[model samples]
Target: MPWVFLVIAGLLEVVWASLMKESHGFTRFWPSLGTLVFMAGSFGLLAVAMRTLPLGTAYTIWTGIGAVGAFLVGILWLGEPAGALRLLAALLIVSGLVLMKLTSGH
Candidate 1:
């Protein structure tokens, strides 16, 4: 299903984002390669899902997942701050994503 593809794409987006950070501005060889591979995968799935999903909805959800996922990953694994305001912002992004999915009509 397109939704399934989209969700997978979003998750891959998260992986790519984390890998990008690990790449150290593409200085690290392995992480840089991994970033490119995952980025391609995420984009491929996104294009497939876009065949049916609305542009705005698909894009927003995809980026929302990436943003929130990367945020959590940073906090959990990269020693990034998990400040209250940052957590609230992530929560708001999630809320918006839920609303977008519900009203997508596809």
Candidate 2:
């Protein structure tokens, strides 16, 4: 339901972020178009999720997922640094998301 939409939205956030990097400040046509499409889809799904989930909880989880996903993409795909501290920060963001999920009654 809403959670499904929320997850999809978060994933789309990652995709759009990657596309944004690929877009080269929107000079590249195809990646720029893809970025716009996914950005819209992500926002739409986030709005859908907000109908049922608490606003802060849903937003935090969505951004958390996007941040972690984008960071991994940066390291693995784009050759960004995979330092211990960076990895640890990513893990902590994920842990926070899990803790929020577990504690929230919604």
How accurate locally, in lDDT, is each candidate? 0.95, 0.95
lDDT of 2 by residue, 1-106 (tens): 8889999999999999999999999999999999999999999999999999999889999999899999999999999999999999999999999998888786
Clash counts per candidate, in order, are 0, 0
Look at candidate 2 and tell me the lDDT of residue 38.
99
TM-scores, one per candidate: 0.97, 0.98
**TM-score for model 1?**
0.97
Scanning candidate 1 in windows of ten residues, the lowest lDDT window is 61-70
